[model samples]
Target: MVSPKTRRVLVIMPAWNEGATVGTTVTEVMNLNEGYDVLVVDDGSKDATAKVAAAAGATVLRLPFNMGVGGAMRTGFKYADRKGYDAVIQVDADGQHDPRDIATVLGGLETADIAIGARFADKGDYKVSGPRQWAMVFLAAVISRLARTKLTDVTSGFRAGNKRAIAQYLDHYPAEYLGDTIDSLVVAIKSGCRVTQIPVAMRPRQGGTPSHNPAKSAIYLLRSVFALLFAVTRSRSKIAVQEGTL
Candidate 1:
């Protein structure tokens, strides 16, 4: 087991027109005591997101066009894999994720292949609407049963991935909205990665509109269920093939 200090970690922030918050987010992550480098993937924003992130002392990767969070995350994973980073941490550029929890997430990587910063794991002031909360609970239960592990927050994006997960995601990542959270976890679990969650506090976005509205949330939930089912079928097929039954 490599020590945390010896491990090369990259903090990847997928930003799209987050000019108002990316700079401060980058600065805060850079100020952490863990000594992790920061990389901001500007997903073809029309604003000054790229320039602002670069000015904030973070390496910025600008996409040719908007690719959503999942695509940006794939780019970051490829960068990390090519650069041989020992671990990668995903943080939101809208200032929802706390930089102080970076170390806590990384700490989970010492024993598990992935560490998720779960907002509802220990309870705080984080609150969602009644309908959204019900949807979250339903999805969490579904994911937990499928993964055969207890998961409190299935949709949380604040997560740390070790070398194996980084390498896996470089080639196999979901390319849909909210895929970075739900679909990515299913991929990681089916690929035999050990995953655990740690309690973390979340802050409201500092700027820009949220990616999900009420209508989008409904679409997200529906698509996510289908995606989860597809993941399960794929996993079963792989198992059958290994057992010489497929």
Candidate 2:
């Protein structure tokens, strides 16, 4: 087991205009006494996201403008690397990610460079329909084969990464559509990062409007296929991880 006092674990929460729930989410995590250093990257929020997060006891990093989840997460990784953190866990600011399971997800890093919290691993009531579900299934199957492991939710944003994974992400994390989750994983796996999944239940988002819609879900499959193609075809980039670090 990784001792909270020994390993520096930074929980990065990417938020966009989530003033209503960011405080509560941060508070819950802070109360966990898990020795987690919470960092909330305010992705150019127009509202008081930065203020709320800071007030909730998170180290708030306010981006100049909105840069989606991909951009926000990349920034977080860079911060972690600069600060010499042992691990980085990407948690949603919308409260869909449960703070109780943060340790379980972090524990997976003991066996793998990247640990994803899977919602559909017979542990959560979360369900998706239409083309989005099909796209997720197809992507998961293909990625599972590539990673040589079965992953039920490859698109899950509730994921944690060790030092190696952070270095890899800094080298290849993308900001395009679906690139943050799908494309990011493909690059990490190809770069020799071992990945594993931890079953976790997803909670309803406490605040903020749902980002997905019927129109978006309708085109999810087509775009997802294209994303996969582009990710694999991109030129490979590798980074050197420090000795004795994951």
Candidate 3:
């Protein structure tokens, strides 16, 4: 394990039309004493998200068009892998994720390959609607069973990945919306990366509309279910092949 002083950390923020919040978010993360380098992947926003992030002293990677959150994260992972970063932490550009908790997430890397900052892990004021809460619990159960470990937040985007997980994602990152959450977890666990969650409080978005509305939430649930099933089936097939039973 590398010491904190020696480990090169990259904090990647995927921004899409978050000009109002991206600057503040970048500045906050860069203010940490952990010496984390900041990179903002501008996901082809029509607004001045890229300009604001760059002006905040973060290295901005501007995509030509909106590639969604997953695509932006994939680009970040590739950059981390190529630049030889020891670990990578992803923070939301909408100001929902607290920059102060970045250290807590990184601390999990001491024993796990991935550290997820979960809002529901402990009692907090973070509240979700009835349907969404139920959906999150159900998905968490499914993921926990698949990974053979108890997990509370399967959909959290506030996460950190070690070198192994970063390298795996460089090639296997899912390209769909919310792919950075559930789908990426499947990829990490299948690749033998250990995962754990740390309790963290979340704040409401500072600005910009949320990507998930009622219709999109339904679509997300359906797609997540199919993706989880596919991941499970694929894992089982690989196991059977390894056991010479395919």
Candidates ranked, most accurate by lDDT first: 2, 3, 1
2 or 3, which is superior by lDDT? Answer: 2
Q: After superposition, how far is residue 217 of candidate 1 from its true place, in Å?
A: 2.6
lDDT scores in order: 0.84, 0.92, 0.84
What is the per-residue lDDT of model 2 for residues 1-246, given as tens digits with 9 covering 90 to 100?
455459999999999999999999999999999889999999999999999999999999999999999999999999999999999998899999999999999989989999999998999899999898999999999999989999989999999998889889988899998999999999888778899999999999997888889999999999999999998887655563343334
Q: Is candidate 1 or candidate 3 better by lDDT?
A: 3
* Count of backbone collisions in candidate 3: 0
For 183-215, candidate 1 gives per-residue lDDT tens digits of 778877776777888899999899888877878
> Which parts of model 2 are misplaced by more than 4 Å?
1-5, 240-246
* Number of the predicted model whose lDDT against the real structure is largest: 2
**Taking the tens digit of each residue's C-alpha lDDT, what string does model 3 give over 189-212?**
876778998999999998888877
Candidate 3 Cα errors over 4 Å, as ranges: 235-246
1 versus 2: better TM-score goes to: 2
Q: Estimate each model's TM-score.
A: 0.92, 0.95, 0.92
Please list all clashing residue pairs in model 3, or write none if there are none: none
Estimate the TM-score for candidate 2.
Answer: 0.95
Q: How many clashes in each structure?
A: 0, 0, 0
